[model samples]
Target: MIKVDNLSFSFPQKELFNNISFTLEEAQHCAFIGTSGSGKSTLIDILMDPERYLFDGKLEMDPDCTIGYVSQFSELDNTKETTVFEYIGEPFIKLQNEIQSICTEMETSTDIEPLLEKYQFALDALDAIGGDDFESNIHKQLNVANLMKRRDSKVADLSGGEFKLIQVMKEMLNRPDILIMDEPDVFLDFENLNALKKLIHSYKGILLVVTHNRYLLNHCFNKIIHLENREIQEFDGRYIEYNFSLLQTKMELQELAVAEQEEMERNDTIINNLRVIATYNSDASRGRALKARVRFQERLEARRIKAPFVEIKQPNISFGVDNEMEDAIVVSVHHYSVGFDELLLDNVNFEIKSTDKVAIIGANGTGKTTLLRDIFKNNHASIEINADVKVAYLSQLQGEMLKDANTILEEFIDAGFKTYDEIGLYLFNYGFEGETLSQKIESLSGGEKNLLQLAKVSASKANVLLLDEPTSHLDTYTQLALEKAIEKFKGAILMVSHDFYSVVNGMDYVLIIDDKTIRKMTLPKFRQMIYDSHFDKDYLETEQKKKSVEMKIELALKNTDFELAKGLVEELEELIKWL
Candidate 1:
């Protein structure tokens, strides 16, 4: 129901999109993906309100279409005393209040005709939203989100992640023609994430979600709109298939580029020989041959392979250590209990050995962030840290750790960088450039802020890192890079995260908090727990075979063996059928 044509947008320092176009139709779920700070969120804002910006584009949307949006950093007003049920039914409540006001006015006003018309319109709007049964619908949604117990709880009292999900529920129940969610899965626990997945899958209207969560990307989207290098690539398939196609194309391009290079080298040698002969003998034909070869070289250069996808840039993230601990427990917590109004964690014990990578996992409101904060502070009597260990922390609430009023350069300067050149040089590795360094941290996107946090962590030279939801606002490429960095780090790590792929791939083991206590679980058991709780019975096996076929197909195509590639395609098709 929406279309963008020849759209181009840029800031003063950088061009975000150039002549990019895509269409969103009814019942289509589109995943908007790109590199960190690639303007995915900016483009969504433009789509929501084209009149708000001066840009070159044609945004054609159905006039009757109503849009529901959930932004990445949205939060509830803490002073407002609204219950979860009332919050989700605000639209319904508003319409009902209008109708009641009109009825009351009709009894006292001389102009009853206008009041009658207004009352009729309000009734129609309320009926359209099913205001009659909105209470029941709200209950059902709360139950689906596993928040039935908190239906009467104040929304402001809910945790950040829970509040985000409630916002989503509010928008969904409004039943707009289009729904756009930016990083809705961020900070969500596993159960809440599962609820979001189900909601996206069951949404009947057009959906445009910006997320880097691998689970959501794999399970929710039917189309992928990838923005990279000021260009857009639209894939009309699942993300898995889209990713495999990109890999296959990269392989083919690389193979063809190599062949072209060899041909160009041969032409260069022939041209040189012809020139040498002409210089020695003054032969006219020799000169003509050299001229013809030069023209051929120009043509080859014009048609050379350009693989933008293959050259997609990811941030160079590396965590440094000043002094690596040797075979000792870097952090130890014994009989640790932390909570505010109620007991969340009671006498939980966990330890991180030197060079060990551990993940602390639990449900929402189970004191995961609280425990991490306690460790970072190292102030509790039950917590112990090695005297020689240094620490760095990446908070899930990036804004809390970052000064909002400070510019990027100023933030770094305050963080202990001595000179402008040093700060610029260091920030460049995290994708911050010269002009962007002058921008305030509050003006930056969520992903950009997270990258800034990572840069700070890397520069700390700490032997132990406490990372909480590090992959939340990062792009897929950055997330992969972080996994690599985590794998290569030379110190002990304790992370609190809900990202399944990051936890499974990067962490050595898991410390699961359950029933107010801590329990250690091996990676194998953790993997099985995820599969049993969320995935299909044969998903793991099917994914392995699919990956194998995809690689085989890439190789076959690169070698110009069409028959082998076709056979591999058939095998992949069969695997997809089972999926």
Candidate 2:
């Protein structure tokens, strides 16, 4: 459990938040929701003591409780060769050593036999907590984070998603009583998001998660704490309830300010009349009335003014005319296989018609990105032909494109875009303004980087767009705005996104890339497929049977029934092979 009392923080010229007070009881999950630059990440940094931002607060915690924090970026030391298991298990090594020391000290005493037994008991307790199933826990964490296959891969070779997941796994393995996560769902797909939800549901600890994904917040959190106008307020329901509460509060405050202004005007008129009467009659009574009127004026001046209203603005994009189509193909892949020696797509044949809006969907690592890359490479190879189409690819980890040496405005210019005034106007549409446009790209957050990528793509005037996980870090409002832009685009679109809402609500056709093949379906049919696939009894029954066999073997081993466990394992192996 944790509590914050009288917390206030301010920057050089502005207060970020003030008088913030809240209590997070054990096992309670809470989410922080706000617009960009609204101090969501700043609050997390203050809690975690990362940047020592100015603050006056008392953060009280249980004496023995531990806190684990996961950042948006993973900063593992790449110079050292470390395995996934070692990385996860590193947290417990200190406890393991302490247990060893206790045992050694008790071993040399004859009169300390009971003490030795106590130390043995303590060691067993620690092992039971995390040591016994450490390996399995690592696997489960990696699986939940969608980094299972990359366990043996080096940290340097991981995709952005895999790296972020590893950070999550490392924090989970620490088994702290309180977990503070910033943008925990940055690169996760649907399957991994569900897995993370289930894991959080099962956790018996406190979670303070900051994320822009509404689905994750709606599914995982019961409390929503909003930061607005340099203050914090807690809502006791889901994200929708919190959002409605904020709207109502804002409306009430606006009405109150109006009434207050009217009252002030009325008081001013009464004071003016009293002053005129006192001017007409100079006496003790007149002096007393004047003093009383001045007191009212002072009281009026002491009242705090309501904070100004600020609304988050989104990017406005108007795509140009669609390019003319010719006899030559825009995109074609023939017998293409891509991956690290493993074929993700095999003998795949696909073509993109001019001005086609294609949605790529699959489980994580099923070659959606590979297909996009193939298209871009194919298009680049045919650039000499007049019929060849221009392709622009937007990656999920667009943050990597930002350089410290260039401001966002400079980066736009460096990317060969003309018209500084036009670029500044475009950036303003995407929420960048004045000082923000002058800020280095490296100073921007993940969400800001995503906006920059959108700006760059829009300015390029490319005939084809290849976007991979474009909505991964975007908030719902921004995602909807981007979806609108995509819908208005007249050129060819080949996008790979795991945001199911975007696919179902935006794209015309869904392309399921799996089992080394690309299967195309319409958005309506794909939604039906998702529905039927989940609710079908026969399918559920088959999956249940498979899980049943695995559970039986696990139970047998736990009970020390070797013969039965071996038989069950063999049967499970046979079933797996047949499948």
User: Cα lDDT for residue 168, model 1?
Assistant: 90
Off by over 4 Å in 1: 108-110, 545-577
Q: How far out, in Å, is residue 336 in model 1?
A: 0.9
Local accuracy of candidate 2 as per-residue lDDT tens digits, 237-315: 6764554444434444545566677888888898888889888788888789878978987887788365432244555
lDDT of 1 at 440: 93
lDDT per residue as tens, model 1, 95-213: 98998889888889998888888988889899877789999988888877888998989988898878988899889888888999999999888888998887787677889999999
Q: What is the lDDT of residue 475 in candidate 1?
A: 92
Which residue pairs show backbone clashes in model 2?
A: none
Score every model by TM-score: 0.94, 0.72
Best by TM-score: 1
Provide the lDDT at 233 for model 1: 87
